[model samples]
Target chain A: MLNELRKIQKKHGYVSEDSIKKLSKKTGIPVSIIYGVTTFYAKLHTKPTGKYIIEICDSPSCYLNGSLDIIKYLERKLDIKSGQTTQDKKFSLFIDSCIGCCDEAPAMLINGKPYTKLTKEKIDKILKKCKS
Target chain B: MQILRKTDQKAYAKAKKLGPKGVVKILKDKGLTGRGGASFPTGLKWEMVLKEKEKEKYIICNADEGEPGTFKDKFILVNNPELVIEGILIAAYTIKATRAYIYLRGEYEYLENKIRNVIKKVKAKTKSKANIELIVGQGAYICGDETAIIASIEGKRGQPRKKPPFPTVHGLYGKPTIINNLETFANVPLAILFDDWDSKLTLFSLSGDVTKPGVYELPVGTNLRKLVELGKPKHKVKAVYFGCFGGCMPYSNINLTNENVCGKDCMLGAHTIIVVDEKHSIVDMATNVAKFYEFESCGKCTPCREGTMRILNILENISLLEARKRDLETLQELAEVVKETSLCGLGQTATQHLLNALKFFRKEFEEKCR
Candidate 1:
């Protein structure tokens, strides 16, 4: 069911009520239960997000190594806060737990691709690359 | 370094010759333990599943390495996947499990293809009977727990359930199951094939305020100072946290072995060493960790959910200089209750860092208090 939901979210940018209903009808799992499962997980969402989701690690190792500074820079550059999507829906930002790249510190995953050892300039280049 | 000192498929071939009981004896003689923080005896755990009368059994390789400071599992998976796969095959054969799953964390979605390729190759090369599959996690830290991982696999909310009808007796789909960390399984072939391999060698993920931050495979009883030096601290190391679950210890003479650290009133949980310099405030670190637990708590138990929330609030207040004199005592009392009353390890160890901070660095918290 999670794999199916992920597939739907991959296509639609997020799991919608219609998708949940369709999944329920197909799998015989009640819509309410599927909705509950959707909200229970951090990856699954009920709302639409931007094209690229930026999940930055703020766990102890990353935070101590200045992940907050990276987060602040990304927030300023995108003109949005953590957990917010941009007006054009090009990007969404979130505070992730540990993506297990603590060795690099100041790390994040942009659309599931890891961007490690981040600096403001690196973030700029990444954003520019995303835009291009 | 080979994670298990050897990663050849010869171990699987050897295990086939020795059979289940013989392989269990090798693991027992080596005294291998789980590497995913719990340190439960690996041989005993396997033996439990072996003793079960149920014929249908399942094996799960827990790759949900979500603990705040731990990344060694990722290193092992990426660097020594063949060993992990061979270990998995050996385990499946030992317990007579026909199905096996690798519950890889979702953040590692990039490695999915790499792991799948390795699985296909290893299974084909071994001509194994177990049907191995990889199931990626959907972002829940609690799913790292055994029961919770089972629940998530069953397509339910990833919440932990009561144990003692343990996973060994009654597990996935009401059948006997054996779930072990990927690293724990990686050690199995070492126990089976290598006669002189030391079971004490363990991986430590060292990060935070260090010049060289990465994973190091060292003996279990390696000194804390030596482990930190491997990372090359830039400033006077003030404290070290053992993967956020073991609580923190002020810079003092300590060792990294489970028993040695446990004797010093800290846990070497998952063997993750986060070296903190004197420049950082303990209050800030505690609040940061508190917030992590609050966010990750599954909300099944009130003590854990509410306790972590309130613990975070208290730590944040302390960090912001808005805490009262009694708030310090309140924090300790709250931590004690949360530690004693919580159902799962998440809640039980939630306030460990703060409690340790208050014990070793009370002055820092008091200075911040109004």
Candidate 2:
């Protein structure tokens, strides 16, 4: 069921109500059940996200190592808060749990790829490349 | 690291030669425990499942390494996929399982293809009956719990279930199942091949307040000081947080083991050694941990959902210097209640670090309160 939801997400960038209804029709599963699974997970998106999704580690290890600074920098640079997407729909920023990169500390993921040991300059370079 | 790096099928070959009973004996003799923080004796766990009457047994490799500061399982999977595959095969063959699943985390989505390739290669190379499948998690940390992982795979909300009929007897669609941490499975081959592999060495995830932070392979009884020193601290170390399962321990010459750390009311869980330098505040660290639980709580049980939010509220007030004197007592009472009444490990250990901080560093928290 999750894999099917992921397939729809990959194609549509988000799981729409229509998509959920269609999936429920095809799978013979209840729409409420499908919605429950979709919303239960942290990764699944109910609303449309930008082209690129940005997630910074907000757990203890990263917080101790200056992830807050990196988060502030991204918010300022993207002109959006933690859960908001940019006006251009180019990026969406979120403060998520640890992504298993504690050794590198202060890490973020862009479109499912990890960017470790982040600094303001490093984030600048990453976002600049994302824009291009 | 050396033990985890070897990809030889010597252990599998040895297991095949010795057969099921002989293999369990070898694991028992090695004194190997589960590396996934539960510390259950691996041999005994396998023996229980093997003795079950159910014919349709299943094996699960718990690759969902979601603990905040722990990544050794990811290290094992990325560095030596073959070892993990061989370990899974060993478990399947031992218990006569017809199928197996590797629940990899979605955050580590990039590793899916790499792992799938390795699985394909391993199955092709071995004439095994167990059909192995890799399922990526949908970003729920509670799924790291064995029961929760099963629920998620069954297309549910990934909430942990009550455990009396443990996974060994009843799990994964109600048949007898054996779910082992990816690291625990990785250790299976080593235990079969080497006589003393369990006590010789293990991987430690070292990070925070250090110049050189990475996974370090050290001896079983290695002291916390040695592990912290390997990270090369830039400032004097004040305390060490063990994965968040184990609370913060003041910097001392304590061995990084359940026996050693347990004496100090801390657990050496998953060997996640996070060094806290002198510059950081205990209240701030505790608040950060509280916030993590608040975001990750599944809200299934009232205590966990409400308790985590309440703990965060109190910790936030403490951090902001607005906490009343009575708040400390209330926080202590709440921690004990949540620890006792909560449904699963997430809520049970949620307040552990906060309690630990209060225990060892009460002065810091009191100064913030009236």
Give the candidate number with the greatest TM-score: 1
* Candidate 2 C-alpha lDDT tens digits along B1-370: 5655574677888899989988888888887788888788888999999999998999888999998888888888788888899889999999999799999998898899999898887766666667898888878889999999999888888999998889999999998898998988888888788754645578899888898988898987898888888889999999888877678878998777678888888887788888899999988999888888988899999898999999999999987889898999999999889888899999989888888888998988999998
**In candidate 1, residue A115 scores what lDDT?**
92
Off by over 4 Å in 2: B195-198
- In candidate 2 the C-alpha lDDT for residue A103 amounts to 84
User: Can you list the residue pairs that collide in candidate 1?
Assistant: none
Given candidate 2, what's the lDDT at residue B365? Answer: 92
Per-prediction DockQ scores?
0.86, 0.83
Instruction: Report the lDDT of model 1 for residue B39.
Output: 87
RMSD of 2: 1.5
Interface RMSD of each: 0.7, 0.9
TM-score of chain B of each: 0.97, 0.96
